[model samples]
Target: MLQVKHLLADKGNRIYSVAPDEPVLAAIRTMADHTIGALLVMRGEELVGIVSERDYARKVILKGRSSSDTPVQDIMTSPVISVNPADTVDTCMRLCTDSRVRHLPVVENGKVVGVVSIGDLVKAVISEQGAEIEHLQRYIAG
Candidate 1:
């Protein structure tokens, strides 16, 4: 089975993070600049929470809260669900589905290594299937 480490190896695990005390607007700007959906809320080196577009739409826009005035901690999802590098893609798929979350921070030795999204997992699965199909086709032609 494909693992999170395998996906990260192919994708180049780069973690984008924001501070909890920062304004939500800043986080939004960073996300836009990176073309990403979420940011890890970090306090120094510790992973404190996660902020996403969904959080902004639901917590700030819906409530008519000013993004510039609001801190990420106020809208960020805390007590994050994380995974290890050795975790299987199937395990991540189940975790994301069961938790109703799109992202999972990869932790190793209590340090954040990378983050994986639902899209990443799906892409990995599709790639794996494609490779298997190619291998089968080669075998059949032999």
Candidate 2:
């Protein structure tokens, strides 16, 4: 069973975050610039919320709210569901599915470490499958 730590070891567990007071537009711009879907919202060093593309589309665009005027705290998902380095990829998959969320921030000792998305877990699963297939093929060739 592959652990989240294995993934973080390769990715170096860096989480991009923004202040909760930042404008919603700032979050949107950050996502666009990073080519990512979400941003972890923080107040100083404390994790406060999470902003995603869905939040902007549903809360700001649909409601006709001005992103430049509204704060991310008004839109971000609070009390983010997080994971630990020791958590298994299967656990992360289940959490994302059950929560209906694509991103899960990893934390240790009350500090944000990294963020994992559904794509990350899927990629890991594919890599594991490929390795297993290669092993089986090698056995058959032998």
Candidate 3:
């Protein structure tokens, strides 16, 4: 079972975050600069919520609100669904699918370690399947 740790090891664990009181426009700019879909909403080392492009499109743009005037807290998704490093890729996939969320913060011991996306889980699963297929082919040829 490929774990989140293995995925993080390959992709590099970097947690990008924004403050709750930060302007939504600035947060969106940071997300664009980083090429990330979401930002962890942090409050002094504590994970408060999450803000994503979906939030901006649905909450801000659709509502015709000014992004520069709105705070991240106003549009952030709270009670974030998180996973652990030890969790298997399959588990992560199920969580994301069931929750209808694209990103999940990896939390262990009440500390945020990294974040994983549905894409990451899918990639890991595909790689694992490819490796297994290669092994089976080698065994059959032997």
- The top-ranked prediction according to lDDT is 1
| Model 3: residue 4 alpha-carbon error in angstroms | 0.9
Off by over 4 Å in 2: none
Q: Write the per-residue lDDT of candidate 2 for residues 14-112, one digit (tens) a residue.
A: 778888889999999999998999999988889999999999999999999999999999999998999999999999999999999999999888988
Candidate 1 — which pairs collide? none
For model 1, how does the per-residue alpha-carbon lDDT over 1-142 read when each residue is reduced to its tens digit? 9999998998888999999999999999999999999999999999999999999999999999999999999999999999999999999999999999999999999999999999999999899999999999999999
**What is the alpha-carbon lDDT for the whole of candidate 2?**
0.92
By TM-score, is 1 or 3 better? 3
In order of appearance, the predictions have TM-scores of 0.97, 0.96, 0.97
Which candidate number maximizes TM-score?
Answer: 3
User: Where does model 3 exceed 4 Å of error?
Assistant: none
Error of 3 at 55 (Å): 0.7
Q: At residue 120, give the lDDT of candidate 3.
A: 94
All candidates in order of TM-score, best leading: 3, 1, 2
lDDT of 3 by residue, 80-118 (tens): 999999999999999998999999999989999999999
Worst 10 residues of 2 by lDDT: 9-18
Predictions: Cα RMSD each: 0.9, 0.9, 0.7
